[model samples]
Target: MHRVLDILATEDGDVSEVVNRFRDIENTALRTAFHNCAVLLRMLEAQAGLTPTWEGGPGAETQQAVASNTKSTDSSPPTKNAPKRRFTPQELQPFVDETQRGKVSVAKVYVDGASRGNPGPAGIGVALFTMDGKKIAQISRAIGTTTNNAAEYTALIEALKLAKDLGIQQLYVLSDSQLMVNQMTGRYKVKHPQIAEFVAQAQELAKQFAKVSFHFIERENNRLADALSTAPIAKIPNQRTDSSSQELMALLDDNPDEGRTE
Candidate 1:
């Protein structure tokens, strides 16, 4: 809404035409806002030009219809296909430039995990953000049935693997799960035998990086990764426990800690 107001206030030439174009919007509140802003714009123009009355040309009837409909208290919901204002050519380039900022070499990785019913269906989400905080890559996938903490470790493991694939030497990792962060940092021990294997795999992958750090972040600040973690079951390919996760676990279990103790 604020963006629309800025467009109306700054756009040059045929402001009334632009105002009329938005009059067909089905949302009463939005249509009314456009109408009122148009009126104020005309009033300001009249004062500047020292005119007797503001000129609202041929589209004046459409404006009146918009105004009249705005008064209707009918509780019908707004139409889903309501007209939306498009960004002008001037606005497109900046958006593109902003999005491209994440294509750099170093990135911050955010990971999250979600489970439907503890050991029920589960998924993990990983996002890579460039130094300037633009997301360059995102991964969300169903990892079959798993416990919540196991899913969290899966997210971390996936993130580390992605960072390795990207050849990212430095990673600033963040997750909403404090337990996962602590386990990765070795502040907490991995007691679950199965989870310990996954944790060991993640630690091995993290070794590939020249430098990597993990931090516990608040859930609100991790919205993108969190949203991806809960992707619909239909959208993700279902995998069995005997597949990738287990394969990686087995590979790590063979070594049992790179010929050392944890």
Candidate 2:
């Protein structure tokens, strides 16, 4: 009934024309269902402060007369707070045209994870870019305490969530964590019970898109996301920090591999 109401709300046709469209259905059961639907529609119209009168010119007058003779007055009115305005067909026609003509665009994403110690202070970073290399968004957040792999999984989850928000149909995920990429792509089995839930969440998010691919890259090629991952550690004042800036600098300067290629 609501679907019929929504259709009628957007169309400019008279009620009789609407009824005739339903009446042409060859199935007796479907015709009976449409008849009941039409009755419910008339009652709804009356409740919306409109008098139920057919407007299909002189031919519809007889149909309206027969309907009026059989109709009852037990119908309830619309609630006082019911919304008044509805979208017209003209307003939504452009959306229909665009849907039929437009093609889905793909988005590329980069993700990196960081931890001060193996299972210590951690942060996750994600970078979103268009197919043409234009950066769309970057996000970095500190997770209280977790392993490097957990942080990596968290970053992938965050990136997928952002892609969903952007309505991206295709995604290419690049990450420096081979373990994360392998596990997400089903090449490696998740052995740790602690990180299993996070991996499951990432897999669920991947299903929301039409297509997604994960790639592993050396840390050198993932510099932007790596820099974002370490930004928070660099912001601490020397006086209040446990470690000096030089030590932090050395940690950032250390390469995951000395002779790795992009």
Query: How much does each candidate deviate from the true structure in C-alpha RMSD?
Result: 19.2, 23.5
lDDT of 1 by residue, 69-165 (tens): 5654443222211343333333212111234342344557778888765555888877776544444677777888776777888889888877777
Worst 10 residues of 2 by lDDT: 92-101
Task: Name the lDDT of candidate 2.
Answer: 0.59
lDDT of 2 by residue, 1-262 (tens): 3233334431222233353356456878778887898789877756644333211211223333445455545442222123333333332121111231223246667788886754557777777665545456677667755557777888899989887877777778988787677677776666566567988999899999877888875554465567666565445333323456645543433323322333
Candidate 1, residue 249: Cα displacement in angstroms equals 20
TM-score of 2: 0.51
* TM-score (all chains, Cα) for each model: 0.51, 0.51
Residue 55 local lDDT, model 1:
18
